[model samples]
Target chain A: MLGPGDDAAVLRAPDGRVVVTTDLLLEGRHFRRDWSSAYDIGRKAAAQNLADVAAMGADPTALVVGLGLPADLPAEWLDGLTDGFGDECALVGASVAGGDITRSEQIVLGVTALGDLGGRAPVTRSGARPGDVVAIAGRLGYAAAGLALLLAGRTGEAFQELTDAHRRPRPPYACGPGAAVLGATAMADVSDGLVQDLGHIAAAGGVRVEVDPDALEVPAELTAAAAELGEDPLRWVLTGGEDHALVASYPAGVRLPPEWRVIGRVTDGEGVQVTGRVEARGGWDHFRD
Target chain B: MLGPGDDAAVLRAPDGRVVVTTDLLLEGRHFRRDWSSAYDIGRKAAAQNLADVAAMGADPTALVVGLGLPADLPAEWLDGLTDGFGDECALVGASVAGGDITRSEQIVLGVTALGDLGGRAPVTRSGARPGDVVAIAGRLGYAAAGLALLLAGRTGEAFQELTDAHRRPRPPYACGPGAAVLGATAMADVSDGLVQDLGHIAAAGGVRVEVDPDALEVPAELTAAAAELGEDPLRWVLTGGEDHALVASYPAGVRLPPEWRVIGRVTDGEGVQVTGRVEARGGWDHFRD
Candidate 1:
């Protein structure tokens, strides 16, 4: 993989097509420096964009980062931020190919992830057919739960893991290409909550997605945190965003990878639905209150 | 030719390799609201990134824009910005492939341009050799002159072109691929003043670049503005940046393209030099005062 120091970096696209996705993270908007370390912000930025590539059923090969920061920002912070990008890319054998740096009032990171499909037909959101089984890989509400702990000033050892999840999500990198190999019909990453993201697939596929609430296995961390805070853990599971979980639709009777759990089903309709109830929409919208 | 609304965009990299470049522009730092319209800002953002691709001797195929804006920002502004992107891409027959939008305190844009080499060897900054003739393909001082007019509060029909140049630069898009076809030994775009940018090429190529100041054709606009502002016109030509002019070195005895003018030559040694004098470096540096 080519690196920075040139006008542009070159990346190999052996299959004659490249998958590209971008994400933007702003300081005080996406993350707070006082709460999350620079490393956390960088890793989160990288993970979110990389997950987009994975959702396309492609293996990420490179990332181009465009970073804007105040002039007075510390060099150490930048170093930590780049290290975070490097570590996250290393997780799935990708590299930071190139980037641009500029001065801004606050820290802003724009990451573009490039992926290779390795000749497999891309699994798109529009391909989910009626009767396809919906499955998900990776944690659902851990990041949201972690955010709640941070907001409540809960920094005890008991809440450390939850808080860390909020700071930096761990996306299931292998599940994207794995799902493709397993013949996934449609796929999307849960960056904007499970329901909202599923709605995207449903709308694109011209079908309906029904999630079985009972099938969702809530992690103990979320349950414990919800009990301590007197909040419903299921809300976080359904509406929580930033978990970067990969969810896919596979034809019925197809064997799924071990990490995926059956969560729902697709039908001939439109939008997403909870098994026996209509759920209110809850997800992050940049333009909405 | 694909557009946004997907997890990732699929671009055809027919040559099995893609060239990538990115640039980040902040509202206050890169452009002032009073000085530039949303359309101008968007077009400028696209131009700067696209110029980097052109500098690499590749044909730009697509761009991914990551925009961070305040939630209350006007919808018309966003629409205008996207139109500018579309207009700029149309100039080179490219497309805005995909992007992400998020909330931020100030408008921040991160643009990544992807280009196809089209079977040509990439002309890199490291390829210049001793005796190679240095040449330029676009305007040099218009943008810097425009900025000077804006700073001096000289806004009128007489200075409108300069002011507009400050707002939106017209990079020589065709010169990059043209230079490649003509066998340019090394190439770079003059985003950061002529001297500073050539210094990059010199450093990368491990050769000395000598500019013949007498040979630089100072445009009448720059000369008139310099006279009105009591500044040296040569300063704008030599040190003014943001022109997005393509400069390259070609081997001796090779026929130069009609649009490219011989400015100087590459020689043994290192760093950039003016034929008879040592000039102070002047260019945009994010970290420098």
Candidate 2:
């Protein structure tokens, strides 16, 4: 409603800088109709991109979407998709601006998110100095646990929690701007699990991150679900992805955001470790094959 | 190479504003491998999106691409695609700052373009006034002519000109920023043919546009190709699309750029007409079903 009719939507950037990020979600690849509803897919897609903006320690401001749908798709499907996008944007006080529509064999949604930096330098992944405290602002293993439940042919009320997490990831969007205000040094979103994403910060900052298993604050439900499935809960927290939690490192004695909890520390080493020991594996790698 | 290893790329917007636009190109729907090489398809896709930035009367600054390719796709194909994108961006002094890559069953390219306002008011399509001189920059009907030549199975040097135009459109990119500085009232890019694209401006501005057929500078090859195919060259120029040319209207006596040619004038009426008569048809339309 706030001047979305213009050529480009106007957004306020108190720090005189904006962070922009985009992602493409292709049907049958990123999501499946059998697993994700039209509405759920829309919210998940928008959330993932918005989470990227938040990972930069910026407040989400606006989003522009380009959707390609097949000709046979029902009009109601598009309406539901738009409704989902609007619902998610409304949560952060952002608007869904103009978008282009074209015909394709499969549904493709391209989302671009705009963010405002609120009077703080962007907390990038390249500032994790040695001895910095690495903290997280949200869950780590829920989405992957949800995926496990779905794969196990589980349904009904007993599996609803896992299903909901996979359908719509509730990333810690507000904590990103809050962490930036609190003076976090380096940060990234936990989209590709804790270990893989932290490895990005580690490589960029030229330091190793030592995560402590005993210091983790994982939810009770994830632990129960992993126990039921005869799996390691720590593996779920370390390797499961798509939670989009904000993870950052701060200099010693720097005040941390209320939602953030210390889980690790930066050290003068080559890679990431768990409790002073390096893990042999990590999360998703797009190009390793 | 300038600070490209980050979660988000920074672009300078000296005027405190930017013109942003996006589009998606899906394989088998937007382009065919048999007709266009990977490089040509990439160039065409970039040209189409860059034309949108030009339509807003802004100079293109940077592009962020989201590429989805199948796992089996050769690395060389990606190389060709990136080379084409780099070539086009280099022409406008722009760069591909950052992008996301994901695996998919088919090729899908989601392109977002950012631009600088250059301290000039953006030329939108809602400001055309009666008596404004409507003009166009760049070639018209060439791409359509090329498609026609190929469809009719015209081969060898006889149809080479038409074939080339369809493969890659050479838009007048600088004319967009130029028209903005010259006080053009309203503007759009001619991607959906002259008459069809102009119809958008006419409908949006609530004015009629009268095109002079004799004033048109049709290419000699288009006329010759039309004769060989037994089609109307005038119709091709009026209805052929995908040239990505900039079209705008100026106040009377306003000096126009060298590349721009006066084609028509705005009138106090509805719809667009050719010379003194209204045409019954034009170019591509979605939802025709």
Best by DockQ: 1
Model 2 stretches with alpha carbons more than 4 Å out? A1-16, A276-289, B1-4, B276-289
lDDT of 1 by residue, B179-233 (tens): 9999999999898888888888888888888999888998888889999999988
Those runs of model 1 whose alpha carbons end farther than 4 Å from true positions after fitting are: A280-289, B279-289
Best-performing candidate as measured by TM-score? 1
Writing each residue's lDDT as its tens digit, candidate 1 over A237-276 gives 8878899999999999998767999999998987788877
Backbone clash pairs for candidate 1 read none
lDDT of each: 0.88, 0.80
What's the TM for model 1? 0.96
Per-model TM-score versus the true fold: 0.96, 0.94
